[model samples]
Target: MLNKFLDEVCSHIRCKMAHNDIRAELTAHIEEMQSAGKPIDEAIAAMGDCAEIGAKLDKQHKPLIEWPLIGLTAVIVIIGGIMAFTNDYVMNHSGSDFMRFLLFAVLGITAAAFFMFFNYTKLRDFTWIIYGAVWVIFIGSLIMGTRGNVSYVFLNWIFIAIPLLVAFAGFMDKLRGKGMNGLIISTLLALVSLIPAVLTARRAVIFLLVPFFIMLLAAVYKRHFGVNIKSQKAFLYSGLALTGLLVILSVIRNPYRFARMTDFITNVPEGNAWLISALRDAISSANWIGGADIVYSYAPSVAVPNLMADFALANVIITFGWLAGIVLVAAIIALIVRMFMITRKVKHDFGYYISLAACVMLSMQFVISVLMNLGMFPFMGVSLPFVSHGGTGYAANMVLVGLILSVWRRNNIIGKVPRENKNIQPLVEYADGKNNI
Candidate 1:
């Protein structure tokens, strides 16, 4: 009995000691016991009851609240507050912009907190309902939504509604087998919602499709490739087919997409010199920390800096400068890499699919944003994540991060299911072949 107890205690100690310091101290005590002429088991027994040690170790390693994501939320909130104040300051001290910012910020924080605390399994089962609701709200917006002269359809309610819907749908999918379906539905809904926007020449809506395209492409890739594609010719063909479709669509809708196809194509100056000059000046001023005040300033009679749709990239470059541009790109790349890592580590199909969806979303956003900035594409007016000053875009991005964090938390809690009723069957199980009748 003593030997058994000592062995259990030693094992507990090994499992709990994550650092070298603890290991060294424990080893020294074991050595001292041996030098005192006690046998190994007897020496271990002399160390006293392990109940206290076991409890201590458990306390040490117990999961605390995730801090990194909390820190990110804090940073976002702070930056958002500053942006709101600046916007208000610029708008003759009217608090309307700040109020809008607060509304979006509060919604985003609430959604994030819910995702962090809710049981993922419950969310997963309701994926379809959430998916359907997004489209319903979107179509309803078309009927009741206010129209803007610049864009065909402007649904303020739907703008807020869709992100909340997507966040919930994403949550459900992340917790269940049909999670990929949620992504697919979300992508389809996003595309469908943009139809009116596109018809009205709302170029801002076009950028929303970038994420949809990426999600669709990833889904096709996974479906065709299965678990491993290296040995499968069918998967290779499927990948080619999907890529071909995307290319065809791009060419049909936006022929300018092919301008960058050939390396020899050159930029046309085409009377845009003044616009380019202004952009350059703005960027130079910002680089020296003196441009924010002037960038938004327009002569009372002159238009508010509306250039060609292709000038969006120039706007970013001019507004933020080269250094900030590089940092933005690096941060986006890091997010993509991290998402991929999480996808790889997840054992559940739901978690894997959700992670992949997020990966596609972030990756596509980065690529399109960079492409637009470089004048390789038209300016679609999509706000850059974490830097742009739009309420809807900021809220949508916050929900995206919340979903990703939820998945990360779920993955970390693997093999650590919350205590449940013993009478309930496991939610999932694998066959062990021992119950043959």
Candidate 2:
């Protein structure tokens, strides 16, 4: 009878993905009634109309489409396609580059769709596995030894860092209520994760490290790891001190990097600062509607060495005008804001952590990338999200988007019904043995 009732109820639910959880929740309620010595028929009848109950459950558990985000992503991809077209045809004169971008764009979109439907909460159970996988990949990258291009090593770590950090969030959650020991353990793990980036000796590590630290410090600030307020403050101070010390040590060790920094600050004409000057000059000379003549006169037709990736923003402003650049920036900003909004609506702690980390990472990448283009910050090889032309980066950004969408999709649903079933309520009432709506 209970199965029949469930079947009737489920028949009204359009979301088949939610059926198992709904079944489990309804089963728990029916079982509770049976344990209370209520007749099954009476309990089933008292639960109200199957169709109405299922309809309400369906409404509550319905997947959120996040169309605004989706639309924005599409618009940005179109913009990227235009940039690729321009870069290939007008600049590189290689007809093949645009097709490559198109292939990756399709793959990225497909990846996002897969992750959108994927159950991200399952990641919580495999936190350590993911953490270990990151370590293994990092080791493998080292063994492979750059293979003539250091980007091979960089790519391996870059793709893994986001997921590793997300897993760290889950790891931290598991340590809640363990007090100072938990804090120490989590901090150790966080530092351990930084080893690969540090060993790579790439400033891009800054992009990964900053966001992960934000996630860690945020957890500490909220007392999520069971540390008292004073201890949290001490942790914060200690972290800042450690960061400063590491930065100083890094500069002392990498004399060439230090020289580049000094040159940028001193405005040495032949140093890396020239890239910044060129970017500014191009922007300054740009007409608001068309390509800048100054850029074409001085630089390659693409306007920069890495016009498709690191300095894509400069190309946008130089080739398409500030008006087009502003629209692209606005779309990226909207996507970041949309990701931030998702953090608020996520009910599950795991989902919340993943979304929050992804948001912070995306926001930081966008800020740093823009700064790199504008010459406010050193070029750390940070690519603009979605707008940049690296296949790995494009795919990684899409995966993050998909994970966030997965979180939003299941915001009101749970994979497992709690044993107590406190949130489960009667769908109908019985008054004087009469069915009441």
User: Residues 140-167, candidate 2, lDDT per residue (tens digit)?
Assistant: 7667666434446565454766778778
Q: lDDT for model 2, on a 0 to 1 scale?
A: 0.75
- For model 1, residues 1-437, the per-residue Cα lDDT tens digits are 43354344445543332323333345557668888898977776777777666456545543335455456446535544554555456434334646766777777778767765554544456666765665565467556765452233343322433343344335433422233444445445655656645554444343445444544445445542233433333433565588579768877777455543332124343244333334444545555232244556752112225321223334434444555455445555655666576566655445555555555555555566566555444434544454443546566666666666766665543343323334644433211121121
Q: How high a TM-score does candidate 1 get?
A: 0.56
TM-score to native of every candidate shown: 0.56, 0.85
Best TM-score among the predictions, by candidate number: 2
Query: What are the lDDT figures for the candidates, one per model?
Result: 0.49, 0.75
lDDT of 2 at 258: 90
User: Backbone clash tally for model 1?
Assistant: 4
